[model samples]
Target: MDFETSDKVKLLQEQIERFMVKYVYPAEAVAKQEIEASGDPHHEPKVMLDIRAKTRELGLWNLFLPDPEHGAGLTNLEYSPLCEIMGRSPLGARAFNCNAPDTGNMEIMAEFGTPEQKEKWLQPLLDGEIRSCFSMTEPEVSGADPTGLQTRAVRDGDEWVINGHKWFTSGAIGARFAIVMVVTDPDAAPHQRASQIIVPTDTPGFNLIRAISVMGSTHGGGHCEIRYDDCRVPVENLLGPEHGGFMIAQARLGPGRIHHCMRAIGMAERAFEIMCRYANTRVAFGGPIGEKQFVQEWIATSRMEIDQARLLTLYTAWKMDIYGKQVARQEISMIKVVVPNMLMNVLDRAIQCLGSLGISDDTPVAAMWREGRSLRIADGPDEVHKMVIARRELKRFA
Candidate 1:
């Protein structure tokens, strides 16, 4: 893969970086205050609206999708750097209408949704007029093993009735609809048992328990806990083919991991910068902490690790474009384990370098630390991914 960034993506990278500095950075605290004042942690702060408008005006919107009609028409390799810039701030993705769960949902809908389904749910989402969620992980099942999913969706005349318990339904609290993975055929093959159904949040018996707090903060459309107690949507609400939910879910993860890993790298890059600055300026004894051997080592190691993870991430994206996502599964799993752990390693060094200030929210490091911890578990846990990587490698030798 060419190391040189194309003129087009280079321009996008520069614009997104500028957007991050001029808008997302300033809006972080403003958004927090607005949400606090509104008494709704998930409230869409007004500053976000301004950010969105500005991104749209600059023609920097829906960048995650490769669809020329709806998105920036960039391949995974082309989009990687742009995604990294957007990953620097928590608000960056949303500013460009390319946030998670929503991005994944949009991808599947664009590929699978029928014309009527696209007209009703997909367009509004593409336009940023509505948000959506994925309801797949369950409180009762081991999320890492999705084939064991217990949620049931029964055909009831013209409607499908859903019933199950779900937690960590990311972005469910304020979403317009959810793409729910449910068992429509218990007797079918493990991978073919579940189907994805679209359930509007307002549908009867769609019970939203609450947004589960993460590290004592429930901001944005929080990771929600919800239940479908006979919740019903029209039969036409099914997404993709029947018994194809498992395949669709796997399809989304490969590209989504590229976004997640690159974004984590962006956070690590910011934290590394913050740590180096503090090391150089914060004095102890007779000199800057950066002059100390331990601090020097921390900075050196962080730089090496960040660059290594980034190259691996970019390589994975390139492979996904050159080969198909399925062909690049090993690299995908490898990065899924490598990048998040690299992020945590960098964050830990930065935090230790900052001492008390790092543990506190004074710098973005601690928040990034808290948030980055989940990356090891989200998508697929480090253990599961490592196992997959190892198994794939072992099969070649055997």
Candidate 2:
């Protein structure tokens, strides 16, 4: 893989770096204040709207979509480094309309939606005029196993009726639309018995129960508990083929996991910066904390891990460019396990170094720490990725 950045990618990285410093970082507090005052996590903040406008004006919109006509059309390798810069500020990705759940939903529509679907949904999403979510995990079942899903979508001539309960359906509470995965052929083979359907939020019987908070934050945009109580939509809303939902989910998640790793590396970088800044200025034992051997060790090790994770992410991106996502599964799974664990370590050290301030909202450390914890389970739990890695290894030996 070529290690040198193309001039185009270098320009993108520089632009994103400046945007994050000049705009996103300053807006972070304002966003929080808006969310708090509204007491509605799902409400889009005015500051976010302003940021979105600026991002769109800068031509940074829809950078994740690989299709040139629909988005920036950059290769995965080209997009990886730019995403990392956006990752530095957790909210910056969305400001550029590249945030997850939405990005995954957009990719699904781009790849599978009929032209009409694209015209009504995909275009608005690309334009940043609306948002979306994916609902697949069921609270009552072991969601790690897709075959264990209990949600059902049944056909009725011109319409399909969906009935199920889903929680941790990330980004549902305020999204204008959702791509739902449901069992359409329970009697069929386990893996091939499900399907994906696009459901509008205003459809009858579709309900958002509440935002399910994890580790104390409401995750603005809302990871929610949802119920489709006989919610019905036209047959035209089905995405991909009947009983083909699993493959589509996998395709969406492969890129999703890599994006998480890219952002996790960014989060770790931010934490290290915060750690170093605090270490140098804060005095303890009659000297700067940076003078302490243990603090210095933490800083040095953080640099090592963050750099290593970034290279792994880049390599995965390069492989995807050359061999496609299927051939690069091992590399994707490897970073899925490594990056989150590494970030956990880095964030823990940062929290310790910052003393009480890290645990508090005074710095962004508290929020960063929460996000690192979530990465362990979000896309696929670490255990699931490890299992995939082990199976691939055994195949090698065979």
Candidate 3:
């Protein structure tokens, strides 16, 4: 229950805030122009590279990983606030090498990979020399229930041949490799039928089918659809134990969900600021919009909702730090559903407050709004999280 900020975390948070203000926020516009000019939604703009360099120089790189040997040695509680700051800008997380798929992939490697596997893939990912993607969702199955995934990985002498169609493979376009989930034991228990394996993007039969659009915009490093038709990797590439994919995936998502919630809170905070500023300054019906009771109510409700979501998220991070991911599953599921819905509401009011400008690209609200909407689906849909929470609560009563 003690969520007090440590001195090291406080210093790091201040440094991250300063970095965001000076570099990340400013670079957003430059990165947008570069991506637009390149005519590719997934293009990694040169300006982003510069920002990454600056983040490294400031020692803000890899803030997400808790491994002392490879990362900042910060706990989930400590990293929570830093994640919120980065969430303020879409480019914020990547600039510091704390972005998703990479973060989750790195954790899996550190926790489960063989030494050789770590040397080849994990090291490059940690160094930010390469990027990665997680391919778990399938086109034919309901993504919410990963146990129903149909991707197959069959043993073939020294190699594992993988055949699957995966979509919503985030960050696949620029990723050098993918952490793929495949059904290796179709006859095994449903929960233990699949295993995770590392598939190099260059491996034979591995294909990046296309980058799927979200809310009409495919942001850089777009979510992708991938086909692995007889894709092969060495036997040593299996992540964790055989038929252990479900366990690894659950572990990966615990922190990932928290990271998403933290960023959503930051996005909501930014939207709230914009909404309040616009309402205070804009004239409506011969008076400032802030003077109206309805506008004031939106501002008040937004502030309350943002703080509520933030406190819940921080509390969850603290629980994960104090207890373990397993013990904090209920809280994780709770925030996964609560924070995104809260964010959507806040963003909607912000958009309404800004009038026509809110829905346009002239401001970041529209883009953030779209991202907020996607948060409901990504990292396990809201319905799935709700089911988890309900099951856990029912077990308590039983």
In candidate 3, stretches whose alpha carbon ends up further than 4 angstroms from where it belongs are none
Q: Candidate 1: give the clashing pairs.
A: none
Number of backbone-clashing residue pairs for each candidate, in the order shown:
0, 0, 0
* Residue range 1-398, candidate 3, lDDT tens digits: 67678899889888988988888888888988998899987889998999898888878999999889989898888888989999999998899999998999999899999999999999999989999999999989999888899999999999999998999999988889999999999999999999999999999899898899777877877899999999989999999999999999998999899999998998999999999889989997999999999999999999999999989998898899889999999999999999999999999999999989999888889999888898999988999889978998899899
What lDDT would candidate 1 get against the real structure?
A: 0.91
Scanning candidate 1 in windows of ten residues, the lowest lDDT window is: 64-73
**Tens digits of per-residue lDDT for model 1, 1-398:** 89899999988888888878888998988988898899977889999998898888888989899888767789999988888888888888899998998999998898899999999999999999999999999988899999999999999999999999988989987799999999999999899999999999999999999899998988778899998998988999999998999999988888888899989989999999999999999999999999999999999999999999999999999999898899999999999999999999999999999999999877888889878999999998999999998899999999
Ranking by lDDT: 3, 1, 2
TM-score of 1: 0.99
Over 4 Å off, model 1: none
| Cα shift from native, residue 49, model 3 (Å) | 0.3
Q: List, residue by residue over 351-398, the lDDT tens digit for candidate 2.
A: 999999989998877888898898999888999989989999999999
Evaluate residue 144 in candidate 2 and report its C-alpha lDDT on the 0 to 100 scale.
79
Task: Identify the runs in model 2 with alpha carbons over 4 angstroms from their true place.
Answer: none
Q: Over all chains combined, what TM-score does candidate 2 have?
A: 0.98
TM-score of each: 0.99, 0.98, 0.98
